[model samples]
Structures are given as C-alpha cells and as structure tokens.
Target: MPANKLAVVTGASTGIGLELARCCAEDGFDLVIAANEPAIEAAAAELRKIGGSVVAVQADLATTEGVDKLYAAVGDRPIDALLANAGVGLGNAFLGQDFGRVRRVVDTNITGTLYLIHRVGNEMLRRNSGRILITGSVAGFTPGSFQAVYNGTKAFLDSFSFALREELRDSGVTVTCLMPGATETEFFRRADMMDTKVGTDKKDDPHEVAKAGFDAMLRGDSDIVTGVKNKLQTTVANVTPNEVLAKQHRKMAEPGTAKP
Candidate 1:
C-alpha cells in the first residue's frame, strides 16, 4: 500500500494476474510482472500510465530455470508483496489427455508455485514484513473428474497456502489464499474447456476477483472466496459426501459424461 513499495506478480500477462497488476499500479505500487509472453511488456506500458514504476519479466514458470530467472531479476530489493499466480489448467478425462500436457500443468501449477513461494516466502520471512497472495481455486474442494491433474494441483495449492499461513502466523509477514470459482478469463479456453458447463456459463468478472484478492491480502486474511455463489458452493462441498461431490463434478467436467 506504500507509494513506492515493490510488488511482484506472476502469470501477469492475462486474466486475474493482469487485473491484479492493474490494481497494484493504480494503487501506486511499483511492479515486477512475469509471464510467458511478450504481452507482459504491453501490460507494463499500460500500467505505467497510472504513474507506477513497472518491470516486465517474460519467463515460463513451469521450469526451475525460469523461476530462477524471475527471482534473479528482483536482485536484493525487498518485495512488499508477492503474488504467486502462475499456473495452467488442462480439462478433459485424464486417460484421454496427452501425458506431456498433464505434466506441464502439474509442473506449472504445483512445482513452479511451490518453488516460488518457498524462495520468496523465505525472503519475506527474513524481512518479517511483507504479504503473499496465492491463487487457489474452488476446484480444489471437490474431485474434478476430467480435470484430474489441474484439480489436483489446486488441491495442493489450497492446502499449501493454509499450512504455510499457519507456519508464518507469528511472523510479521502474511499469506493469503484467493479461492475463486469460475471467472471470465482465457483460462478455460486455453485449457480447452469451452464446451464444458463450468466454462460456458457466465462467470464472475476478473476485476472483481482480483479486487477481492488484493483487499484480502492487504487485510492479511488467511483465505477468501471471491463470490456469493462460490461461498455457497464451498459450504455445500463441506457438507456433501465425497462420493456425491465427485459424481457431480464428473458430470460437469468429464468427457463423454451426460450433461446434468
């Protein structure tokens, strides 16, 4: 929230990342935004119009080397905030999906996120004054029959964010997980889920989701669900049997499954 504090955001070329970066810039935080596209440069340019300093880092977070490249760009500067939002999701029945694509999804959504959080979180701990915002998902609460790997990755994120938050509770730093249900983003289209109900249905605006995450992180809340429907779904998931939830999820996501 400081005028010149540095904020680092990943997966910032589009969707929630882009919206978060925009909000950060508007709020006067200097930014280091990273993603695997030249669009990052464009995003930085637009954000700078609001008079915030911005640096663009283009890196594929699925690899350790890429993650290192991003961190190296930060040098020794203390990041006031970090958003580990780099991840990919693949949807379709697991067996019918390409193994390589699944691995990439896991590598990005799980490995990259964990590695960045481990490294950045250590720095934040040493400083004892910073905030971390992780992009988790409602998908993590239930079995995603078709998006097996993607959902599994989010499950790890949701749990990891909480455990890490607990571990850092006494430290001055804060960790918050932003769990959003379906949002209008390129995520579903890129993941090849346009035909799916979850993908095709109207979704929460990306700006709204980003605002919820930004505000929650600033407040140092441990976790936040972005919308009313998402909150209700979270409640239902908690009360429903796993078998029933899994069946419902399968109908929504699994290839060849009949529409509900």
Candidate 2:
C-alpha cells in the first residue's frame, strides 16, 4: 500500500472494528472510521494518538443514506483499504423477534454491507489496487437456532466474499473474509443475548481476533477463521448436518440457557 494512504473501517466504535482501525492507524494509514453510535468520535480521538489523521462519522450503515454519507466523508481520496465490518445481531426465536429489529439486522449485515462493497470495490477495480476485509462469522457454517437472522446474514457475507475474491483475482484488488467466533464485545448486550449460553460463555479477546483478521487482509488471504477453538468449530460444522447443528446451536443460544 502507498504511504499515508486512506482506509475506511465501519463499525469502528468498539470490538473488532475498533481494533482493526487501530491496526490501520499504527500502520500509518489516514482513516475514515464510522459507526452508528456517538462513541465513534472517542475512537477517532484514540486513533489520532496513534499518529494518523482520523475522521469519525456517525452513520447507521443499515440504510443507503447512511452508506452514502460515509462515502461522502472520503471525498476524492483513494481508499487503500476497506474494512466492511458494520453489522447487527438479533437473538431469539425467529418468530419471537421484533420485525423492526430483525429488519435492522438484515439491512445492516447484508444490504448495507453489500452496498458499501459495490461502491468501494468498483473504485478499487478502477485503480487496480486496494484491499478489503469483510467480517463474517463461524455461526454462518451452522444453522443458528436463536440467531437466525444474524447467522443467515453472515452466511451471505462468507459466500459473497469468496465469490467476489475470485472475480477480482486478476484485478490487483484483494478481498478477504474474517470469520470469527463469539468474542468479548458489546454485541451480546446490543443483541439482547445476555440470557443465552453463548453470550455468557467465555469468549475470544477482540484484539486477537482483529489482529488475525487485519493480518489476513494484508496478506490477501481468501479467508481466516480466528482462534483455534473457532477453527475447530468451523471444521466440525463443515461435516455436521444442518438439523444437528441447529440442535447444538439451541443448546447454547436458547433463552434462559445462561441462568445458573
């Protein structure tokens, strides 16, 4: 990548997204970081301490307008890296989830993500350079009993990233997918998953997961599954039947499972 090149990272207020932004700043990339919450400003401040110019944009990436606003912040600068990590999750039986919340998950995780990629990827193709890292999930490999929408969206992303990478193989631009398992983040509280086993269980450190992903993106790897346990989970998921996987998911994600 060029010196002082620009990189845009979504969902950058916390967790893996925030760490990914930190990695970019440390690597001396000028950054445009965005998230739906006000904390994005604080994140930008922290990133500035890392010595790179940072711009924070508060945007709901679940909508086209929000995605447009985010890109507008980039102005005419060429983005050297794009971390399409903005996402939302909903936990509960699919039928019991609120329609609005469900729609938000779908829009943020699938529609908005794809829209951003389409706009940015085209620019990268024109320049014949740039790297993209998409945050997918191990959950996508299984049928999530209580996280139906979230997992479904990740499945789409995982599949979409692979296909996009293949199509761009000779284009000089690279696309990589980062598939992480459950991690210590605000995601559980935001998703109202605190009552589930997976939410309460010990999770991977967000920093480690982000490092794994950022490195993979820099290397132009096709995909990376963070954490040894998560790697094992994905390996087993490949051969497991959907029905059995769904049952296994229920044991961890069903409401009240977190109760001692």
lDDT of 2 at 155: 94
Q: Model 2 over residues 107-129: C-alpha lDDT tens digits?
A: 99999999999999999999999
- Model 1, total clashes: 0
| Candidates in order: C-alpha RMSD to true structure | 2.0, 1.2
Per-model CA lDDT versus the true structure: 0.90, 0.95
lDDT per residue (tens digit) for residues 187-239 in model 1? 98899987787777789999999999999999999999999999999999999
Residue-level error in angstroms, candidate 1, position 133: 0.3
Off by over 4 Å in 1: 1-3, 256-260
